[model samples]
Target: MQVNATPNRRLVVGISGASGVAYGIRLLQVLRQIEVESHLVMSKSAQVTLAHESSYSVADVKALASVSYANTDIGAAISSGSFPALGMVVAPCSIRTLSEVATGVTSSLLSRAADVTLKERRRLVLMVRETPLHLGHIRSMASATEAGAIIYPPVPAFYANPQTIEEMIDHSIGRVLDLFGLETSLVRRWGT
Candidate 1:
């Protein structure tokens, strides 16, 4: 699984309270397989969502990442622009988290790190997962974009013709990793 990323290149992963907890989990798994280091932070609400959505425990999820930071640890290493990560991704980002990032009002380390990524001109991808979006959600997404963050909703690529949920998950993740210049064959390209 060795790939484009250097072993030292780090990616910050934030998991918020969204229905699609599996997205974050699978992202970590894929990162590990490709030998990319991962730093993980989870909102407290994400723990609750994980219990409702997946069979894995918090410990199980935490184990996937190279470093796990407490959401309350606002002073963690990744919270600073000097940390030199490739980027940050909030897989299945909750609306609450999106609002904070949009307003630059960070209540947790996860959001704080996201802010740092944007301020440092590094990649900041938010997988906003809420549906039936209203005007506020649309406006917040615009704000995040204006701040140099990429709003990547994890819409399924039916063109891939995924036969299983895991394949669908991998396809979505592979595309997201592509944003960081890491390549993976998990995705079925349109023409290869």
Candidate 2:
């Protein structure tokens, strides 16, 4: 397939302990399919969640992206404002990560990179994966949104009539990619 001539876009994907590990993995897959370079980072809890949700190992998850950084690697390129990434996404973003980013608490590389993205005025999408959100969660989401981060919960779309997990994952990731100005045909349109 002929790839687009546009400059290769850089995307930073952070995975947290949230339940939707499949979203992060599938997002990487779609980015690779489009020939975009991905920078992947995962929290320690995310590793455990991935193990419980899928057969892939941490190394396997790392292989999905062009570059992988340790969650504690604060010196990683993506953690710096100098790094010119097109955007960042924290799929399956846990409440802890959300709070950290919202408050500018750089406990890990994930939150630091998110802070960099916001400070640099780049797209930051958080695919929060919790159910029955409380007031604290709502406040965190509002805080991040005020700082220019897009909070996208993994709500299923009935319009697509998803029949499988992969389809649902694709739909969510596709919408997230749209936030980065990437077009995808993974999900059907509303007026179609």
The number of the candidate with the highest lDDT is 1
Over 99-137, each residue of candidate 2 has an lDDT whose tens digit, in order, gives 999999879999999999999998899999887989999
**Distance from true position, residue 112, model 1, in Å?**
0.3
Q: Tell me the tens digit of each residue's lDDT in model 1 across 37-85.
A: 8999999999999999999999999999988999999889889887877
Q: In order, what lDDT does every prediction score?
A: 0.91, 0.89
Work out the TM-score per prediction. Answer: 0.95, 0.95
In candidate 2, which residue ranges exceed 4 Å CA deviation? 1-8
